[model samples]
Target: MLNHEVYHKFAPNQQYSYALSYRRQNVYDEKAPYHNEGVEQEFRLYGRYAYTFKLSERWKWKNTLRQEFRKFLLQTFTRQKRIFSLEPD
Candidate 1:
């Protein structure tokens, strides 16, 4: 598996931030019981936004929202549509 992310602070006070990320994964198996002949590849793209605020002198509060797009492929690099999905938080 491999992943990469980049983050930026958009607010001057550092209260707001955003990030973009990408991830890749590979699965290997000795038998072909399902799709991809037991070997599969996955890729993910993510976008995130965050806001931070002070709740007290010694404590801080933060909220984050993330969105993800996922893609799956067979060993032959053929795209798989049955497992496609989106996630939001």
Candidate 2:
């Protein structure tokens, strides 16, 4: 597997980041016993954005958003995967 990441700070307490990664699976002769099907590669990309604010002397608010994209094998073919999430405090 290989990964690459980048991060940027928008403020002292806020930042955004993303990552790219790739993974591979190997099938040996004992596993698949096929000459043409021996390896498979999968790739994924995702990012996150976060911000924090002071709400009170003893309290604070934080929010985050995340998104991801990927491809995976299904029954007989590959399919795209997309995900998104948001968190607040």
Candidate 3:
């Protein structure tokens, strides 16, 4: 497994970030009974954006949005999954 991430702050209460990751799973093993004789490798990428505001002296508001994408490699049939998330305050 390998992972890398990058982040930036546009303002005191605002920020943006990105992440990349790679993983390999042994879908089949020679010693296993059910063996497909193949391995599955997944590559994932993620991005996020967030901002916050001071609503009051003791109150704060925040919003965040994130997205993710995945790709499969070294597989007979390539598959991918995508996800999105949002948070508001």
Q: Please name the candidate that would achieve the greatest lDDT relative to the true structure.
A: 3
Compared with the true structure, what per-residue lDDT tens digits does model 2 show for residues 10-67? 8888999999877677645645555544455556788989998988989989898978
Tens digit of per-residue lDDT, candidate 1, span 1-89: 66677778878434333343444445545577633434567677777777778788899887877778777777677887657669553
lDDT of each: 0.65, 0.70, 0.76
Model 3: residue 44 alpha-carbon error in angstroms: 1.4
Off by over 4 Å in 3: 28-37, 52-63, 75-89
Candidates ranked by TM-score = 1, 3, 2
- In terms of TM-score, which candidate is stronger, 1 or 3? 1
Clashing pairs in 2: none
Give the TM-score comparing model 2 with the true structure, all chains together: 0.51
Any idea what lDDT model 3 has?
Answer: 0.76
TM-score of each: 0.63, 0.51, 0.56
* Pairs with backbone N, CA or C atoms under 3 Å apart (clashes), candidate 3: none
Residue 2 CA displacement from its true place in model 3, Å = 0.9
Q: For candidate 1, what is the lDDT?
A: 0.65
